[model samples]
Target: MPTHQIQIWFTCTVDDFSSSTLAQTFSTINENIQQVLNPLDAICHKPREDAICVSQLRNAKKVDEAILQERPDVKIFLPFRFLFWKPQDLFRPNTYNRFLAATGGDHVISLIDEISFRFPPSPPLSQIDDLPQELFCNGDNRPADCGPNCECVHQVDIPLNAIVEVVLVDEVQSPNLSHPFHLHGYSFNVVGIGRSPDQNVKKINLKHALDLDRRGLLHREFNLPPSKDTIAVPNNGYVIFRFRADNPGYWIFHCHFLFHIVIGMDLLFHVGTQHDLPPVPPNFPKCGHHLPPITFDSGYH
Candidate 1:
């Protein structure tokens, strides 16, 4: 396979942040990319002429002009402070003249701090166009979206055996926070993490090569399969994982972060199998009924 050129483009100040956290995060991402995209040269932090690094938005015009100036190739990772601009002042419906004016609606990855909501508050256009069908609706069971008090489930009646691949991202989402995401009756393999944001190639993988490289920097050879109830994702960096579906039901894959699930992270994996569901219990509440837990963590509440 040809070496894929994925740029880990992020902007940070030399003044504020220390170099250590950056190093550790970068190392984690480097090892992760090396493991997953084997025989592929994953460039983490390459300073190319094409890459755009913006710090202050002098005005909306400058932001627009600069973004248009540097036609980014793929993932555009925006910094945190950038999103602080008021939506009313910028990116309005009438002018429709904000950052969206610059680029095509390609895959843009924003560096959002998961713990806080810094991005703009607006419903995605699709929802505004038309409300989607209610597959399953428990009185606000959607994690993260709904506060801790709500317990809701929107049943899609999705069959099993449909999903061919699943990637679990550690960090951003961990097992302990809200809903313990459980894939009923099937298991998946864990892929490695993405490119490191700090360190360059040789230095980062050298450490993993010392420990995880049983066959010389090949991590899959040293990967440990799952044998636990809840999978714990890393905190700082993200994880790339894979899984398959063989079971036949409306399976639930949610964040173990209880509040996270309650918000909107909980999703249904409908494996498409051609089989009838087993008989319901004697006192089943309803087809899509949700039995409220006696005591759930108040993280979302």
Candidate 2:
């Protein structure tokens, strides 16, 4: 007989389960099976009373204490920062700049430079004498379907069979939520996932990560990275993935959440020129606008 090793993982408040018949059943099962507790699995109300407390993960008291110890001058404004705390605050460019300044991070850029750097036009690929002219639609020059009003259609043109590395930094809109980003064309290798080493820093923003990367503090597991098509980026951390742009076509990479995609949390990867792609099938359906032009008659019918 094959012995089975069972483990029960609780993701919600166990107190809610304790008063029910299910709790009794679980209690009986606990005698034989192992029960694992992970505070990061769920959000708890009255964490101190709960068996799995999230205090260690998101303790505002600790953050305040750290801030007071590091920068005594900002002690007066701590209450103000907390009083008007908003989720969108985390995404502001100034928030990153402030964090970099506070942490003594060298890799700091101005708000305008950061915006331009992050959302720059697609770069031209290295010239190849044998290859034909490149063809693709990117942010700098979008297709007709992507009109002046279409702010969501961000695109990047990639050379055929080029090695690409993508580092996704979670802005931490919500500490509990993780965005599962999915790429349509290719499955990439997830090489690394980590945050700042400093225990005092509760959250790791993009600037912090870039600074660490610049200083060679971050490590990549190039030898044995797991290949995945979709990856759930950690909250307040970063995920590094790499893949080859072997497929030649327009592919979408976006957050798995339908609502997030609707609101423009997506981008396109245009790989290779149109000549690199295979011929379309005879009955391949057409896409984009195909409205018939209207002609006004001089005489009434």
Candidate 3:
């Protein structure tokens, strides 16, 4: 693929565009065409600690000290400062983008620190159909365009037996937040995770040499094993997971960071048809709907 030569020609006349904007956009189209390029590092690496905070993390917190003592490789636990000038889909008229601003609307979007999720000890999540549908999904299945100022987004529904590939990204704005997402009801095969700004590769099988070579790299692996309920999305990086829709029920896929979900970094997948839903437990007890307790620790709150 690297040995190929490609050409592109574009022409814009005075009638098609205003002169000022066109001049600003087209003046920087520099291209040094090459017949060959260097091979990319098969393994993806995390951003360097020096590159974590935009200001270089001049002031250290107790949490930072504690993190250094424990996970020394980790610099800090904060959402990455974005690189793009604005959030994706900022000007759309969709219900999701109704409240967004130029810089994602809220400067403190993922700014919260330290969170926890605790369920009641009695009614286990396995109770399934017994709980109110609200417990599984807060909003009905619809086209929820989360953006500019949205606090929460809508859930996605999938038919039974359908196969889904979730491409979760750190996004251009919060590129530094490393989310360790977890999927309920089913475990998925992680395809790959990488930090390259521009990555392009076709899906490769796990047993193939391309997959086997990634087993040891600390960065992203091309062929990742399929046993984890949760996996880390490297800071300033991304990861992809694939799963089948055989688990006919409502399930939540969210970042392991409790605070991220609180600020709306979550999604729901409804597997199969309504007929696929199992009846509630026969002797289930009734109780009011409840939201779990969240506590902020360290200096994060």
Candidate 4:
């Protein structure tokens, strides 16, 4: 649903009675939206230097950049200037330790709203001969020891020294909360930003076609970008950025909100090969359960 609903729609009208608080809020919203758009002057359309558009959406289907160059009919990209998507975080050494202590290894929250979206989904116990019996399903024919449905935390691995491009879409599941995404080791250049596709529910199954259209639009619309380590992914909005995966360690990508974190909006990037990484120092204190026995003679498993 979040992926399908990408565009925005709005209505404006002056009310007979006025509330100062509501007026200020609406005015701020109008300015923020306008700031995200680019100047439409002829000079502004001149080619930019040192910036490359990501020709693809690197998901399972692997939408590539060639499409942008190849297709002129797609209308998803509208011109955009990312000067306003700036990072506004502040450093506070006074609360650093307190913040760290609060977030220490507290991933005990239960995942109650998980789903497996396989069409004509296979039974958990269904098996093939080549792979280990326990590889996908357990003895009871359940998906895992948890029986039929144990979901692992979602994660992404970026190859060492590789350049990374990430496209993020926000649906604002929680009201009044913006996720100020922060990466631990490296910052990113905000290369492109675009409006959501008209998220009409009936248009959802039209996702693949919609994405192709939307991405093409973003490619054509990209303009005057900015770079940063942290930026707000506005509620019900989208952002696209790029960075090099040179940080050879397990780095975190998370929201700035303390409460939002405890409930588990987090992702980890295991960058680089084990050989490319530094050796673990002696007695790096173990966390709960340590790690599963990893047979990594070449590098970390």
Candidate number with greatest lDDT? 2
Question: Model 2, which residues run further than 4 Å from truth?
Answer: 1-152, 290-301
Between which residue pairs do clashes occur in model 4?
6-196, 6-197, 7-196, 7-197, 55-64, 55-65, 56-65, 76-217, 77-217, 77-218
Worst window of 10 by summed lDDT in candidate 1: 53-62
Q: Give the clashing residue pairs of candidate 2, or none.
A: none
Of candidates 4 and 3, the better by TM-score: 4
Against the true structure, whose TM-score is highest? Answer: 2
Q: What would the TM-scores of all predictions be? A: 0.33, 0.50, 0.43, 0.45
Query: Per-residue lDDT tens digits of candidate 4, residues 1-301?
Result: 1111111111224652358745654454432221212321111212333222221111222222432232322111111111111112113343211112223332222111121111111211121123233433211234444522233332345677665666555543234444667878886656544334444632112233347445664332323234467866544445556666767865666666655454444454557655676555676433332347846577655
- How do the residues 136-181 of candidate 3 rate in per-residue lDDT, one tens digit apiece? 2222322245233433323456777655555444442233445667
Model 4, C-alpha of 91: deviation from truth (Å): 40
**Candidates' lDDT values, in order?**
0.31, 0.48, 0.41, 0.39
| RMSD after CA superposition, every candidate | 20.9, 16.0, 22.2, 18.9
lDDT for position 240 in model 3: 52
Pairs with backbone N, CA or C atoms under 3 Å apart (clashes), candidate 3? 80-176, 80-177, 82-173, 96-145, 100-148, 100-149, 160-272
Stretches of candidate 4 above 4 Å error? 1-153, 173-176, 197-215, 219-224, 289-301
